[model samples]
Target: MSDLFSAAADELAAASAPLADRLRPRSLDEVVGQEHLLGPGRPMRVLVESDKLSSVVLWGPPGTGKTTLARLIAGASSAHLEARSAVTSTVKDVREVLAGAQARLGERGRRTILFLDEVHRFNKAQQDALLPAVETGLVILIGATTENPGFSVNSALLSRSVLFRLEPLSDEALVALARRGLVAEGLFSGGDGTTEEGPDAAAKAEFEEALEVLAVAATGDGRHLLTTLEVAISLARSRHGTGVSGEQIVLGIPDVEGAMGAKAVRYGVD
Candidate 1:
């Protein structure tokens, strides 16, 4: 019976994994942070609602969900989504993407959203190659960069795309995301403390603490927080004979100490 239960638990966790990850939010409301972008009357909100997104730039530090937001924008639009990473893509890749966009336009009469991740990594020559496509509506460029685009991106290409700055996620928002992750995974099955008993007080508290510290360490980057939380949860479950007990969870002092030492100030807009 113990072996059977263990196997069942493992299967459940495995099955739950994809759904939990996928539930990461397709819509802006589903997104945990970045309220500034999703908030009413915001330019991003208007674009998403109107499906009128154009060539753009997403600027922020690593793990701040730039890639995710860019993808979401592409998904939200009727335009074709084409992605290229500056670190690996060459002028040839740019030309190919442009060609594909042109082909799609001719075949389906669809627009294109060209997402250039780590755009700041591209040299002047690469940026210059994209100017014609971006300017002529052959491609709607969505550039993402960990560095400052103004310093690295060509002035002409930079002038054409609207720049959107993304900030880091806050401890509270990170914690909220973590809790949602748990609930979404069906790991904490229960009703209000009165009903099914849900997650125990100790378990909930520990998860909150772990999430808070992890988020602080992530420095407002939602992707970083999610990845770290996933790893921590996996590790904790492994230690507890795959049961995922609160005691099994790891909490780093660097994160805890950091969270404790810092003054309370919200990071991400939402």
Candidate 2:
């Protein structure tokens, strides 16, 4: 049946997606880092929850949840979200989004939130194209960049938007994120009825050590942490066999080191 084929396709796509993309926070509460901005009564949280968010620039290091926050803002708002990457988008893309925003507002009175990822990559002209719509309130622009917005963003656009700076995640935050990734990958029990009984105390300890190494090597980048975790999981599974058994796939320090290459040493000599 068509429905069965569609379901199969969806499963395949989900399986092929990166662990970071798959584990991305679906709601503001699920987001791991950026506490300063998402904390209670914070300006960003207040604006997002109240749905009164104006044009804003999220400046941060990679993996600090810029895109995640933007997505959450869009999710919290009644606006339709349109996401584009500056690396692949051009002035024409900006115009198209603006045009669509105009039509959506005119026809249904719905606001549009335009999320531009890696916005620093947008040249002057491309960035300029978004100004009219953003200034007129036709589109709520959420520009995310790993670069300093002050130096990269145009003055006009920067002046019109509130700038929220995101800091690198702390080690504790990165560890928590690693735990979440482990649960999402089914390597750790989720306390659900479907939990698999596996791994004795020794294996669990080894896994914990590996996780700590990964968290340290991640260097405050959540995406890098998850990616390394995924690679470590895969490497461990490959060496341990993929059969569903009572024993969990315990990853050792070597496995974590193998996943991260040179950066793994930052965790300290084994």
TM-score of each: 0.77, 0.88
Model 2 reaches what TM-score against the true structure?
0.88
Off by over 4 Å in 1: 1-23, 189-195, 198-207, 238-270
- Model 2 steric clash pairs: none
RMSD of 2: 2.8
Clashes of 2: 0
**Local distance difference test, each candidate:** 0.72, 0.84
Q: After superposition, how far is residue 218 of candidate 2 from its true place, in Å?
A: 1.2
For model 1, residues 138-162, the per-residue Cα lDDT tens digits are 9999999888888888989989988
Best TM-score among the predictions, by candidate number: 2
| Candidate 2 C-alpha error for residue 61, in Å | 1.0
For model 2, how does the per-residue alpha-carbon lDDT over 1-270 read when each residue is reduced to its tens digit? 999999999999998899999998998889887888888998898998898989999998989999888988998899999999999998888898889999999999999999999989999999888888888999999999988888999999999999999999888788788877777776653224226675677666766667777777778899999999888878777777757432365566667877887545433335
Candidate 1 residue 65 C-alpha distance from true site, Å: 1.4
Candidate 1 clash pair list = 35-270, 168-220, 169-220
